[model samples]
Target chain A: MDLDILINSLRNYDGITRKNFIRGATQILDETYNIGGRTALGFGDDASALDIGNDTLLLMAADGMWGRLIEGDPRWAGYCSVLVNVNDIAAMGGVPMGMTNVISVNKEDICNEIMLGIKEGVEKFGIPMVGGHIHPDTPYTALDVSITGIVGKDDVITSCGAKIGDSVIIGMDLDGRQHPKFPLNWDTTSHKTPELVQSQITVMNSIAKKHLLTAGKDISNPGILGTLGMLLEASGVGAIVELEKIPRNKKVSWDEWLKVYPGSGFVLTSKEENVKECIEMLQEVNITSQVAGIITEDKKLNLRHDNQEKVVFDFNHDIIMGIKEERS
Target chain B: MDLDILINSLRNYDGITRKNFIRGATQILDETYNIGGRTALGFGDDASALDIGNDTLLLMAADGMWGRLIEGDPRWAGYCSVLVNVNDIAAMGGVPMGMTNVISVNKEDICNEIMLGIKEGVEKFGIPMVGGHIHPDTPYTALDVSITGIVGKDDVITSCGAKIGDSVIIGMDLDGRQHPKFPLNWDTTSHKTPELVQSQITVMNSIAKKHLLTAGKDISNPGILGTLGMLLEASGVGAIVELEKIPRNKKVSWDEWLKVYPGSGFVLTSKEENVKECIEMLQEVNITSQVAGIITEDKKLNLRHDNQEKVVFDFNHDIIMGIKEERS
Candidate 1:
């Protein structure tokens, strides 16, 4: 596919469009986000960090399954609930401790399927799903999972730490196929062994501890380039990507690949000196990693392929989440 | 009301009835509740406890607002989400760190009102709502909030620690009226200063640190007697209480008071020697306190008034949550 077509498709993707809604809700929450002085990093990050003293920080994040996804397949929705929340913690380079979920369902069958899926995901991720509330008689089915993790105060990775001289790394366990029910969901962890699946997360912790990555975020529904845009927006920087260098399975088409929410994918920024080691660590865990782009002082993401270039996101005017980290 | 009548009424209360739905969901989750081994107290508790090392444990809990409450008053629903989750951590005698929420809304007005309510709650509780996900196009509106707190591993309290002969104390801030739309909601914190409302939580932390309580729980949707029944079930014990000794607002009828979800109400168990101090500390925060009962060896909760005693919950036959904490 041509650069212009791929850029336009991703720019108009529903995954990106849906994020605009966050701005309104967050605006109302803006004042109270830092009500307590212990908030180390509040909104605009994969997880909010709270200082608990003793050089330890607690990480918290929540994600809700889309109604469409839940309606299509409750089991996938349940499994994805864990995957998404776990990835949120993993992106922050924290050790995910546990998760709690709130599920609303009217049917027993659907509830059972979802719970089984969650059980599978929990086993695969190696994180306990300890406790949560169940709204048993809601008119619709929905699942929201929240995760908590811990990281050293100094070893934390955040979305707003990217710098102009950094290299943008795109990593994904590309040996997987798309989910049967949800085409956008690239299923990587399900077929893999539990030990291998968990390494995708622990590898990030090792990266964080070594101070390898300047900023990182999981490739979620917003996909690779879109997720990168969010990190850039938070960091007040931009990137110029050689589109062909982005690691992807050859089986998937370009438009679909750009929007696929992989089971294990991450977009990270690291100093040029740290790129080799960071990619090596991720590769050791079976994640295909490569330096696909370079961070730039200009606040726009420029995509290049086949001697052609196109501007996909201009942070100066575009609003992915319309948020900038409130640094504590 | 007669003892038998009240017993029957509470047994059939909707708050308690709704809990039955949790049985099916939890039964499925039981197998994996302690999958990661880090869970110190999994399931069957107000908050799940996970050992995070350094003599500190992490507490996690989630609560979803009832659809009826959301429909009745979105603002109150939003505020209650925070109140409920914070109380979960407080009930565990932990210091609440932060909360995250997932809100699903299709209407802009309802969304704004809910956010406003959440903002008010965040400010009142003095705990931040750091991060969350928003589903803007759901067919139905809902809100789920999850919280994390920290407590010394040795100092943490659990519902399953009630020992025979422990005094059962019912503590509540009776200086409140019923909510206009939700009569069972005893609205206490909204009118109070942030300091006083926060004291309601910090007092629990103090109690935990002092090791004065054997078992404790916040009075939530299941109300006073129903909540106490849960504590008894978890501890593999029972209680005999004098109904009149239960701290209650004189203005509310006995039936309503027994079923009211108090803003700051707790059913606690403490050794006889520590009961006086526990009550005094709770009372210092305007939470009216009294020793209403004694934990018993029998597996049933017996209620007494005017020499007439009747069993309220037969643990052998009744299952409030159908969960037994996997104590690690």
Candidate 2:
């Protein structure tokens, strides 16, 4: 594979570029991001956290289906909405409690299809879609879902806790095929049994409780490497990843695999001694894990594959989300 | 006011009609509404309550900005998004925690204005907008927000608990003017100090702890009588509400007042012995409270005015939301 070509493609990926606008919109609440002083983590994490006392942190997150996804396939969009949000909480090592959604649609058929997909997702994940609001006569169709979860205050994993020497591990479930319509979507849980899919989520909690990792994040639209770039940015550190070490499905090419949004995947950081345990725990749950890189202090994400080295994101000038870590 | 005209107008109101679709969408999850079995309350309430142990119930709710509102005034729609979600939790007597949103926008200027309005709302209500997802390029603009709050399990208020012989109390903060652009919006908290606005929210918690209100719901797009109709339907009971006894701002006409969505208003029911205490507590927060009616065994909402009474919503034929009460 040509390292420069792959780096260029990832750098210009719409998934990562669209995220650049987030910091600008969110900055308006900069002064009051922690308005009630209860926000334990805010703005830059998979889920913003509220310190609810009793040693528990309440994790809240939201996800909107891409407009194209809604137009191309409403059912898949609805199902992915639940999968994405559930993963957000799971990435934080939390037990997802429930979800609420707001759907705006002009067509009744589309709304029904979306709801059906959401139902399938809820049943598979075992998280209830408790309540939501609907706008029946909107000019266009859109679905937005938000979730709430709970994690022990001490056990909560965050993107900003990665240390300089931590091993950057890429854990992904490779036993999946590309979605029929949306090829970038790695369909891992849809074909698996509910018990197995749920175990994949709960394993993160086990890892967090045991302090197996220093930091973690779910691989989302930005893909594995792009997602790691966000984690490095939040941690105020850098990483030099061995692209060859990233586990692949073997059926998909390396370039495409790096950009795929997996149904069950994570970018985690752990101490050298804990790497074996972290990988083994993930393996038990069907998540293939690999020590792909090491965190650095240079504030740049460098890639080395087949003796070729290149920079994917140089935080000194480039930004993924442009949001710094917000601590309570 | 002509009783027939008033009843017909409210009965045919779009606000109440639009709600008819909610139950259809939510019912799809009927079998798995409590998938993990921790759901203390599900659909049909202002917020779903999850039994999170430790005498605490996690209250979650979501609301989408009206498409018309977003198209008319993006800023106001942004601010109202927070107000509505906060009130949902407050209606259940929960402590407002934090919120997450999903915004889809094709226009950059509108997105910025919405964020600015959200910032103002967060500061006014003292609840942080912790995190959210942004779709910078969508065909239409929409904002949906979800909130998480905590309430004592025993002290939680629900719309399904109103009993026969209970006093139907209407509590509303009437010291506000109609929004210049959106006449149907009674702008209350925008002009009040943060401390005063917050007190209005806290009073519900106090009332819930004191066991003053048997059931409660925040007055939303459905206005006063229509909102009361929903409460009656949920409780499987009815009410006889005296229009004149309902608290109102003298400046606004009766017909328009009955349809106005006040910024801070609620329809509540309580035992006769607790009416005085409930009203007093609300009055202390500048919310005018009055015993306007009584809950009855017959599942019909009867409105009385000038010694003449007319049925507004006959549950046997009319269904507002049409969702039966979901008890833990």
Candidate 3:
């Protein structure tokens, strides 16, 4: 329940460890990130923005389900495919337009179950599953989903846009419980009304349109700190955050709370002048948000609470995403 | 090979046979195809088209590599992920803008190699690989890619736009050989200059802008004839194609020739007024196209060559895509 214990647990978690490889992968992809002029924002962001002209930018992102997740429950894997990709676009403050999926399966039943899940997710999110390819005879079953959305060119949020002296805020929808089947996942959207969950995504759009944040990203598998670490690394900045200031369900312990992947949550940094407006917009859609830290020029994430402070991430020494957005 | 042998070989080829499951998926998806009220063309086409306002439309498509393909050469799978999606947009007479991928792998080496291939593809195609998600822990490796393109709404091509009296034209770039690992693949772009390959894709945009084809689709896993069958099903019409009129590499046998998945080939239909312009444009890009036959009201695909005409697909009993656009 203490700070060190929670930090160690999160750092050692497989979900957090798995993201280290992203740094290396981004290194190889570094060369061709901006091959064309259409790329407004490329790697190390929840969604890449494309300059589509006419004051509009296109947001694109893709997500693949873990093979273990598919093996455990193909239907849940299918549903999560939509959920994760949608979240990626939402984090960028874009209006999701449609989705496409590629599914490979050897069994008919598994494919059917995954399709059923996709159907439900599509209905809940109000986004169409447009077009995709299917492999009927793969040795293993896997599902990957990709999404596209649109946003005004001047109003897009990006991880790499975070700046020094900005206030960092953690916003989360805490009105939910951990999924019964997936322990590390905090289930919020499934139990809530579709209208409420969708409005939660739209509220971020309102925030972006109003220029309430300098930078933002969705909280994902690496959980809150891991997600913040990636955003800071992308922006080439660091932060000193108070662990006690972060919003929590209170029922979940500190260790569990820090690592839970909430259905709707975000890590954002903005000028102090805009924090109140940002918090108010998110609150309108059921997100509880608070300023937890201030971004600094030093490339380290320092955590503080109860008159005790510890270094959680030193980006210069330990790479989280390693990708500096301007370079990537 | 004799006509019967060639027909039977094309029917049984894995590239063509695997598509038989598409109808089953469409049936399951049923009405969810048009969720946002702007899907001009859905499931049974090379790519789905969405009306994005301002006399312009967005084209979206996704493709996943076969597991065997991924296992055989992960690099090629990654490269082809871009290749296939790009071709999908080209076939629709749209200008490709960008692509995103979903990659799942347990090993760092596999991920690295795939990213290398993707980098090569981006440089070659002159398009950017914008953003995507990675599942660092998976039981097996898989790569799925999705693409978006732009087209003028009035000039867009659709699989279901073929008229009863339209001319059937099968155009393909014949300047390549079969791949070493994947024998059924016609590897055209690998050996040629990127300028030439990119020009081939751009030529489709020219055709669209000039207002040419009645119906069109990229020739994918289902080869030429099966792809034609899908077009016919979508168009609510049939055609009798002269089997001899289809462009082919004489070095490959008839059986192998009919089933090869070409790098840049398309099955297109046009009214007589547009036939000359269509063939001329296709030839400018090294795609040898000829007027093969005529579309008919009879819902059947017939193949004819040298005093021998045979019915290849009887749509009354068989369904290639099983989707009749609009069901009118």
lDDT of 2 by residue, B1-328 (tens): 7999988988888988999988878788888889999998888899999999999999999999998898899999999999999999999999999999999898889999999999989999999999999999887789999999999999999999999999999999999999999888999988899999999999999999998999999999999988888899899998899989999999998878988999899999999999999999999999999999999998899999888999999998889988768587
Residue range A182-275, candidate 1, lDDT tens digits: 8889999888999999989999999999999999999998999999999999999999999889998999988999899999999999999999
lDDT of 1 at A62: 98
The lDDT of model 2 is: 0.93
Write the residue-wise lDDT of candidate 1 on B1-328 in tens digits: 6878888899999899888888788777777777878889887899999998888899999999999999999999999999999999999999999999999999999999999999999989989999999998888999999999999998888999999999999999999989999899999998999999999999999999999999999999999999998888889999999999998889999999999999999999999999999999999999999999999999999999998899999999998886655479
Give the Å error, residue A238, model 3: 1.2
lDDT of each: 0.92, 0.93, 0.85
Higher-TM-score candidate among 2 and 3? 2
lDDT of model 3 at position A259? 87
**Residues A1-328 of candidate 3: C-alpha lDDT, one tens digit per residue:** 3778767787787777887777777667666777778888887889888888999998899888877778888888888888888888889999888888898888989999999888878877778788788888888888888888899999999998888999999999999898777877887888878899899888888888998899999999889999999899999999999988999999988888888888899999999999998998888889999999999999999899999888888887987767778622
Clashing pairs in 3: none
TM-score, B chain alone, candidates in order: 0.98, 0.99, 0.96
Worst 10 residues of 2 chain B by lDDT: B319-328
Each model's backbone clash number: 0, 0, 0
Stretches > 4 Å off in candidate 3: none
| Cα error, candidate 2, residue A104 (Å) | 0.9
For candidate 1, the lDDT comes to 0.92
